[model samples]
Target: MKSKMLTVLFMFFTMYSGFSQDFQGKATYESKTQVNMDFGNRQIPEDRKKEIMERMKKANEKTYELVFNAKESLYEEDEKLEQPGGNSGRGRGFRAMGSAGGDLYKNIEDGRYLIKNELFGKIFLIEDDLEKLDWKLESDTKQIGKYTAYKAVAVKTVKRPNMQALFRRRNTDGKDGEGTKEKKVEEFIEKEVEIVAWYTPEIPINQGPADYWGLPGLILAVSDDVTTIVCSKITLNPKEKIEIKAPKKGKKVTQAEYDEISREKMKEMRENFRGGRGGGRGGARF
Candidate 1:
């Protein structure tokens, strides 16, 4: 059955090659992340805890759109108006858990990517080579909408922000000096995680929602350890052609440089929290 599917996909791609120039697709994706908030030994009212969870959930749920053709694709969030007394204010710290700021443009033909990311108040244009994932195709199949999707898995090593360190309270045991506090920098640690993607050959573009690509078909759904991004809607060959262009604004930097800058900024924030400059009582806010 796998061989049959591949054969049919090859034939379909060959037939669609002539119309590739005019074939463009717009896919809307709904992205959500599961967050486990631990307040350590601090005792909190149940009502306040529930409120915090609600705010975090609202902050983590997001909508994105991907515009793609044969060679290049652009993915960015679809902004929405915040509700009254929403999580917009306290959601800054949780920004690292979701998709990065600005537009992500991938050129599959050239194996390059350009991402526009904003950190604190600085805008950075991250230009780097596209990360090629070693995907292992599986024989499992499932139905996503009106398409028959196949399963593919890939293991990726990513730098995840240490949430425990961010909320850890300073030790004020007064071991060395009177009224002294132990300061620890919040850092990102590297870990290996498995990525599962569902693709359908009906849309033969090697594009996915975020930085995921190089699949045999268009990826409809993808999930990692804490987040899941799924395509909710797809529009093919719309009346108006969307211009797929790379963002030119912001200071140019590589991915590594951007990460280093983020680490330094996080450290600064941690220090500020320790110095009683952050939220009330519990060192850092959610």
Candidate 2:
């Protein structure tokens, strides 16, 4: 009886991995993100937490129109997660537009996004150089709809990707392999991410948000800083053959450029909003 059961289990897992690519589902994530500046591991003051909070709070809600299928269906959506209130008069994230779309796998791989508003739209992309999947197979599992999946931890790095190699010896579109010319940034470019997914061999596709894909099932939960965007609520096949793709608007830059540009924009906005002045009797502190 024991031998028979083992064979059945092996057959089931093989089936599950094969079917992972074709699944489409929805999920929600509960995240606590804290941002810190790094100039060689220097510690920032605790009091400054409010300032960071204020910057995020001030950021305007952003949305995007994700178009899947060679220009299939499109929807307008605010892309970034936000706090419920507006920014102070100084204005931070003055033009934040957070949204996205595409097929389960193809969308994210296209690697493009619109930041701020349509007028000030910018691009956001990620270049992952991870070998194999980061998640591990676990004996502990859970049921997401009909699929059962295990958890895994992906420990890897996110760097300012060198676009020179992409150009393949073409000078017109090639960048120097050295990365950004600016002083080397001290941010923790690489991150250790943990993902919990429930996929079955019923599907066959390798697609997940950047840096994560290739598992037995659809990735229901993923966290890797910018990629942490998770499924807050899931309604599987809310509509059939839901497609995922990249946003088309604004400028296009490599993953490395996007990383620095985003944080710098945030930094500049926060800096301008700093030590809020021109206040009443009780003024805002820096």
Candidate 3:
């Protein structure tokens, strides 16, 4: 009975120990990404191309955050946002129909410290190419931030959930905005993506923009294929408390489970919408 009672008390203490302390800081980096698709040898109208490019503009300029602490570290790369030049988007994430976004996550709190800041690390994403891969790492190096930081490299392996290589289809009736029917076919789809990041323990704040964490420090900068996030500056332990957040709460799945869910959701979206504007405004990244 004493042993059981001790175990229960230990569990209680552990749960209560997770009260995150107050912190304030900024994370920033540059991102670069490529969006490709097949037009099926069909010629896309100029207007359609213009519209797609507009969407791409938003995708390339999205932002994402990485968060970490003593418990877990997750990376949600390339999250898109509703507005441009904002701090809400995930890491260099891309999307198609609705609002393009980015998100990446991982849980490594229960594991060993392994390599603090190596030259390269492998990361994995959900896509036809990455679906088979159990894991993929990337290159990194130690640096400085609010504290000691490690530099992460770019892989370009992951892609945005809603993102796809699209080719425009000409409308049958080209009466210049006269209700001309248009078609958009997927040209390319890839899941693997690479990003460079900088993490530090300066303020000992383990919060990033999106699902990024795991370093002995916090993420100060991140970037995707074409987009980059640079934490120009930050202030530690302000008057309020700041907690890291997942792309979307209510996620009751492991890494593999989340990948499966995201994949199925994207697949369903593509099938249901076909050549129309499908999916919601949420942004899911590669």
Candidate 4:
């Protein structure tokens, strides 16, 4: 048994060594996100609701590509051109469409990652240590296209805005104190989500979409409850050289810093909408 184990280790090292010399690939992926919107108690016409849902669907559908080698990778959403004289016709519901964050560049050897985020018409470059999820390996196996894949699962905690809490109003009775008559707005709250990934040992590279990596093999599919990104096409060891470099534009910040910035901006926007002239004269009064 010890001799067999040694043989396995030898083969693993041999394969990884070959990767350093001649291993590069490009992968195309399709990303889909589920949209859920609540219009509160406002009685909206059925026609308007249908129009909102359609626009939300279009914004959620996206395509991306990942170019990678043994040491690094670059993943970016493919830019889609708008049709001539086309109007996006986005509304408040459009925000429910969600975003994939932005372009990501990872250097596995250096344990580094850089992400470009566009929030509130501002660009931020987040540079930080690569996010390493504590993935639990499963014995399950499946065939995805021509590759045999294995399963892994991870739990991640993210801070999300409490949208409902933003609209909370305090009761103003005849006898009311300061604390009893005002609503406390919660800017953000923490939520946990599960990530399931399928990877193939055939590629022998530790890489995946977005901030997902640290696996023993190449990830072909990754899904959370609301979003899923699946590999549609993969080209390994192409004849032409591929470049895997970091994104170099935007104001630099850390992941935590960027998250704070995003939250503040979102809160400001919400407050503005609640008080603007277009928001019905004296904002929304409950």
Most TM-score-accurate candidate: 1
Stretches of model 4 off by over 4 angstroms after superposition: 1-14, 85-100, 161-185, 276-286
Which ranking of candidates, highest lDDT first? 1, 4, 3, 2
For candidate 2, the 10 contiguous residues with the lowest summed lDDT are: 162-171
lDDT of each: 0.76, 0.38, 0.41, 0.71
Residues 158-181, candidate 3, lDDT per residue (tens digit)?
Answer: 534434322232343532123545
Per-residue CA lDDT of candidate 1, range 5-59, in tens?
Answer: 6774685487467566768989999999887876533356889989988877887
* TM-scores, each model vs. reference: 0.87, 0.47, 0.47, 0.81
Question: Which stretches of model 3 miss by more than 4 angstroms?
Answer: 1-34, 63-194, 200-209, 243-251, 272-286
lDDT of 2 by residue, 1-286 (tens): 4554344357557754543444454343333323332212213466674675556443322222222232122233434544368422212222211222211123333442322122113333332232465555555556655554445455554442121111112112232233323233222243444445544433323334323455544454555444343433444444667755434443544434545564454444333323232122232222
Write the number of the candidate with greater TM-score, choosing between 1 and 4. 1
Model 2, TM vs. native: 0.47
RMSD of each: 4.1, 12.1, 13.2, 5.6
TM-score, candidate number 3 = 0.47
